[model samples]
Target: MSKQAATLEADPQLHEVFWIMAHEPALGDNLARIRVSKGLTQEDLEERSGVSVSTIRKLEQNDRKSARVSTLRRLAQALDVRTSDLFQPSPEPVSPLDESVHTDLFALRRTLKPVRGLSGIHMPDFDGEVTYESVRTSFLAANALYREDDYRAVVQTIPTLLLEAMTLVAEAGSPDSDRAARTLLSQTFQFSAQALIQLQQYDLAYQAITEGIANAELADDPLLGAWHVFNECWLFLREGRLEDSRRAALTTAETIEPRFSTGNPAEFATWGWLLLWASAAAVRNNQGDQAEDMLALAEAGAHRIQGQELEAPPFWAARGASTFAGFSPELIQIKAVEYAVVQGNTARALEIQDTIHLSGKLSSSTRHRHMLDVASAHASEHNTAESWAILRDLRTRVPHWLRYQSFARRVVDQLIEDRSRALRADQAEIATFLGIES
Candidate 1:
């Protein structure tokens, strides 16, 4: 081994630091480097950014891992850089070990991204006969499973569904049958991509969405292609490609923008959904005016839809009904609360949360995300008890889903750090669940 390697091996902490730096730039390190490069002292930064000197010291000393988005935005403004610049790290490549660990999804990976050779593509080997009706039914069942937050079941169901749809496409005899088969196949890919995203398998999710978009185009369905683009924007947001997310969403929304007097409700809902995600991306990127504009446009679309749950093509009744739970005035309100939280207006977030009642209209995942924002808002106000209550309830209700949410982990970490005394039993349990050192 090299001398540097020997030094790192001698100090375990140094080894870990080296590993982290190799994968992603440490946020604390980025903050310190940027501050110094600007010739700003800790006190100077504290005064300019309105961040406390103690907090600045801790961040520079690597005692903290992250700050809230609003805090990052303020610091970035002081530094004259984008908020994303502070969190900059080279893109993390998906590890092959991830596939080995998720062995159950191997078939799915094969189905979504088959091997291509000079001779021809290596298609899934299933020889079973499949009809369009059967494929549609399977797609609906899998979509419902996703909506119910049964991700394990959805993952298990997707590979077979994909194979069956592919079989139908391969064996199709008529143009109408071929179109039907490809349409269902595209929808299946969409559902598969959504499940993969929830499982945090982003690389596979990208493949699935890309395949879906291609199939949609082949089937001559621009609306279906638009839906795929919408989900792609979502994937971009989750990956911290905020500018890509905003641009894609805005461009697609403009392309599909509906006329209030004559547009179909489906058009209105799809347009609204894209705007909502654009708003989300903008707010997280600290573009307050752009965020507000996107939100207003979405709210107008929701108003045009007039509480009607627009049906999705192929089989589902409502557009994004299974995943996003459809775009509605209430859904718009949920997003408003999310924006408020990102802006550090916890009071307004909670106020809006209290007024909006989703009942059973939204999916569990959507509802849970909103609840996370509520918990975050409460925590920011030093209402630890209320925050813990919300988090505990969500953990009890959807433990599997909660485990994958980095946002939930962040909130739990903040709660643990803010407490002066030893963790209570419930606090310790949650901390353990979120993998936070308490």
Candidate 2:
């Protein structure tokens, strides 16, 4: 057998180096292997991925245990394969749970790539009569469910809703009706995309968003286009295209700025929310100065929108959605704190946390998101007690909120791995919640 095939036959867990590379040796090996297979030298990788020759060498030599997921993605794209293909297990047999997760991911990629360049969701035919208002209302309901952290509930609701929206799109006769149908259809697909991402179905999530983007463009709604880009930033971040995500965030925020004005609260909220998204992308990109600058700009916009009579985007009247609301200031701070935690600025994160108003400054989902960031900040500082305390509080208060959130899960995993003690109680709590353990 070939080396990769031999390794796989010997031990399915003999990973090549996947997204989260906790094991250095396997990562280095896979990096070198993929490089050779692509007929690229370290210099070629450095030139193509902009990762630097020394850094590439360090990764291949196992001198560096981890690089940003974005860096890996750049290399993978240059190498011409899915990013997951580079993952190499640590020569250990895969666990049943890991196997199951991978199996599902494999199946998801298979099911979604039904055809080539363009995509559409395969929803069953809607037998009932469909109207724009009804489809819009159901989209709003799905948004409400999403903000409430009921992801699976949203997933269950969307397939039929998608069909109904698609049906409406087909049957609309007038220009106004056509616009309404297309926007609702676009928004519904966006919802489907977000739900799938939350559930960690990345490939499928991407396909859904691709369809959403196409529909958004067809609808020709600036706000829908902004929302589409916002979600695209999230997908790019997850897939480690940090630069593209950052660029999209910055550019798209600017793209929708002209739509905002003092007279229109929806447009105002939409622009400010896009700024917040730009800040989010900057933070993920580790551009501390740029992140701060973006947040400052977003805060200024938020100040303008806060006291005005708040209005949501008519098309996406999802409760507690960042875009539709009249700019939640605390929402921006929550993301900043989350970014700070990731950057290992525990003290700074804590200081920002103090400024966030606990008494409804944010939605329930957002407040909990901030709290999750606090827990992660503590965990990053190796303050096990504080981290677990925040986690436990979340489990008690907003029990379902963190369960499906990928960021929350990643933080929990980091906390468990970084903890000094072997007690692993927090680990057990998260494992139980994830159904990975009793």
- Clashes per model (N, Cα, C within 3 A): 1, 10
Angstrom error of the Cα, residue 191, model 2: value is 1.0
In order, the Cα lDDT scores of the candidates are: 0.73, 0.62
User: CA lDDT of 363 in candidate 1?
Assistant: 54
Writing each residue's lDDT as its tens digit, candidate 1 over 1-438 gives 221111111110000001111123367788889999999999999899898998878767766545677777778788988666776533542322234347878788888788999998998788667777777777777776765666667778889999998898988999888888888888888777767765657788899889998998889987787888877876776566778888998998899888889998888877888887787777777688999999998898888877666566656412255443456788789888888888778999999988998867665567778888888889889999999999999889877667556577667767877887888898799777665667
lDDT of 2: 0.62
TM-score for each of the candidates: 0.88, 0.70
Per-residue CA lDDT of candidate 2, range 1-438, in tens? 121211111100001112333355776888789889889989998888777898789878988655544456566666766444555533222221234444444433443454344475553335889887788777777777776766556656766777788899889998888877888887777777766655545567678777777887887877777777767766555554556667887887776675334436666666666666665655544455777887787776776677777655565635325435526576667666766665556789988888877654345555666676687677667777887787777777766655444444555556655656664666586646643322
Question: What are the runs in model 2 whose C-alpha is more than 4 Å off?
Answer: 1-124, 144-148, 259-263, 315-323, 359-361, 406-427, 434-438
